[model samples]
Target: MTSQRAVERGASVLIDAGSLTRCRHRLYLDTAYSALLRQEPENPGVRQRREAARAQREDIRSRLSETLDGWTEIEAPDARTASELTMAACRRRVPWIWNAVLPIERTTGRRGRSEILMLDPVDGGYIPIIVVNHKVTDPGRGARTSRLTEWAPAVDETRKVRSQLRDQLRLAHLYRMLDFEGIASPNAHGGAIGYRAECILVHDLTTVFDEYDARFLDRLSVARGESFTVPSQVSECRSCPWWTDCRPQLVANRDVSLVASGMRADALREQGVSTIDELADFSGPEPDNWPFGSFTDAVAAATAWRAGVPLLRRTDEVTVHRADVEVDVDMESYQEHGAYMWGTLLTEKGGPPAQYRGFVTWDPLPTVDEGRSFAEFWAWLMGKRADAAARGKTFAAYCYSRAAEDKWLLDSARRFGDISGVPTEAEIREFIDSEQWVDIYQAVSDQFICPNGKGLKKIAPVAGFEWRDAEAGGEASMGWYREAVGYDAEPDTTQRERLLVYNEDDVRATKVLREWMSDRAEIEIPTLESLRSAV
Candidate 1:
């Protein structure tokens, strides 16, 4: 492994690249866990994601190296020491140096390695360019870019910029190290090559420098024992190595994060309310810094959490939209590659028993075959709507959330308009906007308050729904997807069946949860009014 890669594995006390981008508490825990010799929990899901990202990074680095014909790539061993890198920069014979290490900044305790350095023509310094594994831009015309040839100026204007904070922060980290060497470009801009690999994406770090400095100083304080930070739940906790260690502690204290996380939890902590019990007992004027508009609802949600009740009705009764002819839809996609499967469950009164239909393709994604599969799924779903209209039956299609399904719906239709049975973008927008399309998640958000979480997995179980597969989850399914499609190994027929079952169960879960919301929530779930009375 490269010296930089070793640091990413997390056993060091010093702040390196990517540290500031994570949760501040995780940064502190990296030092604490390493000092106490606590092992990071072994997670197959995390390993799969890391390995895939690393593979993509290596592929990009190798392909990019081929384009820089005469640029020297410092050997991994030679790249370890700052003297070697500094000497190469001083000589400045070549315009670019690949895999150049930056000298450690002792004052801030920062050390890092870069993918490429473009020597400044006007001065002896160099500008840092980073290569990342994900796409940095969308198809449009705004962001400045350049040809992949040599240390080119970012003059290309073919693509629009995708503002990724982690990407920007990473560039900031590298640039800070360069600044310490007194060899950084006078300009605050940095270059990055995203998954496109077509050109360099330029970012102006002038806006982010303040954020970087503050975060670095904060992390340095944690590392040096100058400041204390406890684990606070944040979205980053999902994939964090310290999750197994911190989640237990959070739960043990019934930390307010168990209900309201991130800034909401932090805001609660600031008001001297740290546990569920404390938040539930608040009967006075709301704190000036309260994050939510409904302090009553917040307290009620906390009360349900303290009572170990998974769900609480917002009112005396919960009502869900139901149609004479209804279709429950769930999509399964492997990352951003493509939506490979669209599973549907059709249910109606006095009709043939509900049937489960899945339109899927095992073909490796990014392949044109994805268009065919998507076209078929779209064609079939629209056919269901057309059938409902012909029968003069009320119709609605339900999905947990529209963010993922709506995205791929338009994406699939746009990409495969030439194919038969593909809907137009305007058609998709009309359908999505109409009452015929219902997002059950929004219904749940309006009708119920979930304490543990509002995720499909968390809420569905409250309705007494269980998945057929023991490991039925998006992250687990992503790992199964690789095997089902022969991504790196031979395709497994069993994994394909597992994917199908998982997708079917997801749609069924939505149906079950919706029925429960409409029929059982009033009697089964605690009322917000009752929770308030108990408080």
Candidate 2:
């Protein structure tokens, strides 16, 4: 529900409580465009994607209704508001109260409030007003708690206490009477109970309410065009409609933000260093308040961006253990069906080039069967390790990150393996704890700072490796999986082949990164401990 205070205080467009709780600039721009132009200022593709997402949300809501029964739905007084709020309530499985203007008098001349209050029934006719929001994926525990703290006060103030008790009712007291709940899908597991629910009570609700009040006032002015600027976040900008218009200017001027990310760019700009050229050529003593803790580190990053090469900041931090027999591993999984393929590229000490292998599930299966497929992959990996041992060569399985690959290995073993299986918990843990399972991404990040990005797709190209499929990406591969597995239609053999090629490239990229780092021994920087001591 939107804050009634926000509406009456002259907000041009009402933002949902969930969205307003994060990224004020995004809300301001969206609101300003909608208010001034009467439509969203988005490109066709963005608009189409938004529409598709909305449809998916609606589908989830419909499915939720089928699962959750016997909940009464309350509609708004106005037809349009009622329709929207009703759908929202149905999806959230809470009773929605619309046209529920705050008791406070209108202060900023706006006539109507579009906020909807939801009520959750308790035993013996007790109903606590709840603020509900839905997310397609896990918003994380910290974020959910922050959202509850932000929304509680507004909900508390909307409470209708008796006239006699009104004098004793403070915002804090009201906040305690209300509740907040978020429904979120933790993973891409497409099932009825895949969505998890989290509820929280705000202890510092009054303080947060005051802060939110002031922040909303400032945002309202921006929404009305007092001031506006495009967000400098590169990730956000890439998907933004104005990116094409803004990118050329940023490039031509060598915007510092291109080299430095997050608040560091702003910090640099504040110091009158606003371009990569200026930063690279900077000769003055270190600024008194360097954002990166040390001037040399900042300069190293700038130099790397300017020269278009990875900057190894600390030689000793580069702890990637090279092996005579290395296996670069990458996995492709449809979250809906669990992990289905484990691809590996094997390289020997004097081998010609990396040899590719894939362990794939060729048929749709139950969760148990999926686990069995993973077990097979594990057996193959162990066989490779055994062959390397027989040849008297050290073997290591290298992956970009340990989080996913490691988790899958352990989880699959727990789900499918016998106590003595190749990927038993004990075996996987020993492998990971030893030098046998190398996380190249962690090693790269610990040693070098790549201004372009740290992603395999970004790093591999600079190391002279390229994917054959230009459209190969994590999301694109997921789409390819759907097509290949015939999730919605007949299986496409071409798509399956493309998926394998994509997987192969991913594993090969890790091998390429490993070799590239190994060859740069001469360029290694000081050890991290020494660098810290010097700083």
Candidate 3:
């Protein structure tokens, strides 16, 4: 059900709700391809999202069953046949309904299923509630909320709202379907249960539906072959099945999105810089506030990409943050459950030779054991730092990107601070703010323009670094994590070893990439000074 494509047109009255919130090209391709080719199976990313949503919904239903009564769950022969069962459950005046499918709207032809349908006693109708895999609320106030088992009319000032665009639009899609059938609550509101499962996030859909209607119509037009759309690089492309169909086309046209994306790519196209060659051959003064790096850097990125260069220097001099002792760290996690491992490669400048250590827990995540593993890792890391400090050596820990490491560090402290050896949240903040931590990705981004992207996998090969495994990526590792921890079956020691090896390579890649940037980058990569005359 997390599929962006509407598979088996017989099961859908129109495009899926996701089309209103995702890339238009994905919707167009999904609609056009159903008739021309069989739909590709959902990728691991989509599968994980779907599974997480399912698990959350089931947990919500289980809690609701325990706390409330008069709940009916829709069960039918198939998805296409579930509409009647859902409608029957609704007519019974149940306070809660699970897995309810609303019939297609006659006017807009939208069909949807809700994880939960909450009855409004005043109107004798139901409000749609969706279950999602991420956090729905933040720590603050002024967000209207409801208890898990009941919806109150007044705002719950104790809770705050975090707006998730896709989840909101999905609620709008279901509400519209119910409203068209005259089964929607007069309240004109819906709710969602997020990963935290703490409370129902109430959304006033009056404004949201306005946006959804326009978006849904645009997607519907694409579906009915009334509009044209083209594929572009987007956040969703990393997991999109249609990338196979879109990538070749982009390559053939030398699309600008290959090097720049989002508003940058759109703005470039508007400026008549649609192709890589046009961007590379640009001869004018640079635009104000060019993203990531300078305008010359973007041109260099385009030129290098077009000419098949891996890395191009954007500055005459290059230096990566290094110290007398360094440790490269990488984290591996599964679908927001928890960070299961922290892999580290310790390289002492003159002391003992480099060593790799992994602090890992095979226990399936969302477990307290996670806290123990995290505390252990933190203790070991601090011990190494202290050892360096005692020896009067400047210490630094590196990661390709600080975002993931920062998130887990803060989260580990926040979630497990009470556990022995775990630091306080303030300590994590102190370390993150200090010069003792470095992001090699930032150093590379500051000094170079990588047309292919600055991902560790993309840049490591240029530094002559290679991973032993053929399938080495975050997505692939998520699959390995499932098998390694026995989330659905018996644990595989082989997969666990594979994960350790992959994690080790990731940290080692950062070590090598940093060294290459310090020692050889300026000499080997095309310099900005050289590309200046050419552009």
Best by TM-score: 3
Pitting candidate 1 against candidate 2, the one with the higher lDDT is 1
Clash totals, every prediction: 0, 0, 0
Model 3, 1-535: lDDT tens digits are 3334433342344766977877878877776676654647779867876776778777877888788878778888887679988887777778888888887664565868888898986777999988888988876788888878788745666667777888889988888888887888988899988887888888989878788989888888777656778879887888988888888999998899888876577777777788889998899766554555556667878888876778878678898788998999999888778899999999987778789999999999988888898988888888989998998998999988899889889988888877888899998999989999999989988887888888999999999999999999988898889889897899999999999999999998998898998898888888655765565
Please state the error at residue 289 of candidate 1 in Å. 4.5
lDDT comparing candidate 1 with the true structure = 0.80
Candidates in descending TM-score order:
3, 1, 2
Give the 10-residue window scoring lowest on summed lDDT in candidate 1: 5-14
Clashes of 2: 0
TM-score quality measure for candidate 2: 0.67
Order of the predicted models by lDDT, top scorer first: 3, 1, 2
Cα error, residue 394 of model 2, in Å, equals 0.9
| Superposed Cα deviation of residue 490, candidate 1 (Å) | 1.1
TM-score of 3: 0.92
What candidate 2 gets wrong by more than 4 Å, as runs, is: 1-11, 17-69, 73-218, 270-272, 281-296, 307-320, 335-337, 351-353, 362-368, 414-422, 520-535
Error of 3 at 225 (Å): 0.8
Error of 3 at 31 (Å): 1.8
